[model samples]
Target: MSKKKDNLPNPFNEQPLGGLLKSIDGFFQNAFQNFQFVGGFPVYEYETETHYIIEAELPGVKKEQINLDIYSNQIKISVESSEVIEEKDDKHHVYKSSNSFQRAERYIILPFTISQKDVKASYRNGLLKIMIPNKKKRIEIE
Candidate 1:
């Protein structure tokens, strides 16, 4: 009798449907957040004891297409492109067309004091690197 009771399966062993549904819902929420599209450039900020580096992944964009504006305590990057249409042929024959685009603005706030004069920006291999040196005090811009 004791051996048969030990071999019997527990009737309470079952999957909790509520807990499983919650887990499935959480997975979909995370997947949707990561799959969203962002039109602007992707940027990352890195900091050191002496300086801060702001790098933007700007592929297929020309060096001249980006503009950096340094305000009182913020740096804004704006890119603009436009498409132009050129018609080389007439009516029913043939036509050559081209499109242009304009870049939009991206803003970043600085955690440390940075002067416009001490900032350096460069573009290499489709990446835009901006180096901002640390300053103890704010410098007046003339």
Candidate 2:
């Protein structure tokens, strides 16, 4: 009867609770999977009126694997990974490789002039520290 049909809930208007839960579960699962691709790598930058210091944490990486370049008002750091292979037997083996990682270029505008020749760097405990010294005043002879 028309009255009985009206009393029943509309199928199209009904919410799919199971489907909503499934979608939320799927989203979290995919996010967790993607997080595994990104490991831990932190960079710290400190600057004083006289100098600047940049430190990077690079564990399990060699000093030769890192590259630092200085451009006008900017500094770029990058890391290159070496290929490694492991052979368990004639039919079983594993190959591990990674492409180079391009770090973000840090832009620093100096309050005063600086000289590239005065820049000094050191690596210790999986950390790379760079010290950039401000240019010294030169006395002029009249």
Candidate 3:
């Protein structure tokens, strides 16, 4: 009886649903691991004893259009930008395009507590840099 129980057939192993589920799972795994879908937002982060440095790329965005919300250990940044493109083909056809996009957001999570009020950010040359101060205070002992 024990031998018969151990040899019982596995239903999923003989079904097409198992392969379909595996194919779906693999497609998503490859997409996430390739990092192509979210390739527009490139970030570089490093940690120090007193501060966390984060640099990101936001091309053609102005400082006034950017927003930042800081939490104990998370950083959220968003921006909106627009552009107007106009072209004339010789003397015949004229094309004009006005495109607007909102909510280019990048959220970062860290292990250390950061000061919300003291966070500093600077933007120049299509690059944005931020420095987050550690909440843990250092006491100087003489």
Sum up the clashes in candidate 2. 0
Instruction: Please name the candidate that would achieve the greatest TM-score relative to the true structure.
Output: 1
TM-score of model 3 vs. true structure: 0.53
Model with the higher TM-score, candidate 1 or 2:
1
List, in order, the clash count of every candidate structure: 11, 0, 0
Report lDDT per candidate: 0.72, 0.60, 0.70
lDDT of 3: 0.70
Candidate 1 is scored at a TM of 0.60
Model 2, position 121: C-alpha lDDT score: 81
lDDT of 2 by residue, 14-111 (tens): 55766556655765554433222144357787777876787877766678867777766555666655343233454545332322232323344544
**Per-residue C-alpha lDDT of model 1 across residues 34-90, encoded as one tens digit per residue:** 222236778899877777889988776788778999987789988766655566666
* Per-residue C-alpha lDDT of model 3 across residues 15-98, encoded as one tens digit per residue: 577766775676556433422224357879987897778998877667887778888788887775544435457675654343
Residue 84 accuracy (lDDT) in model 3: 45
- lDDT ranking from best to worst? 1, 3, 2
Best-fitting candidate, scored by lDDT = 1
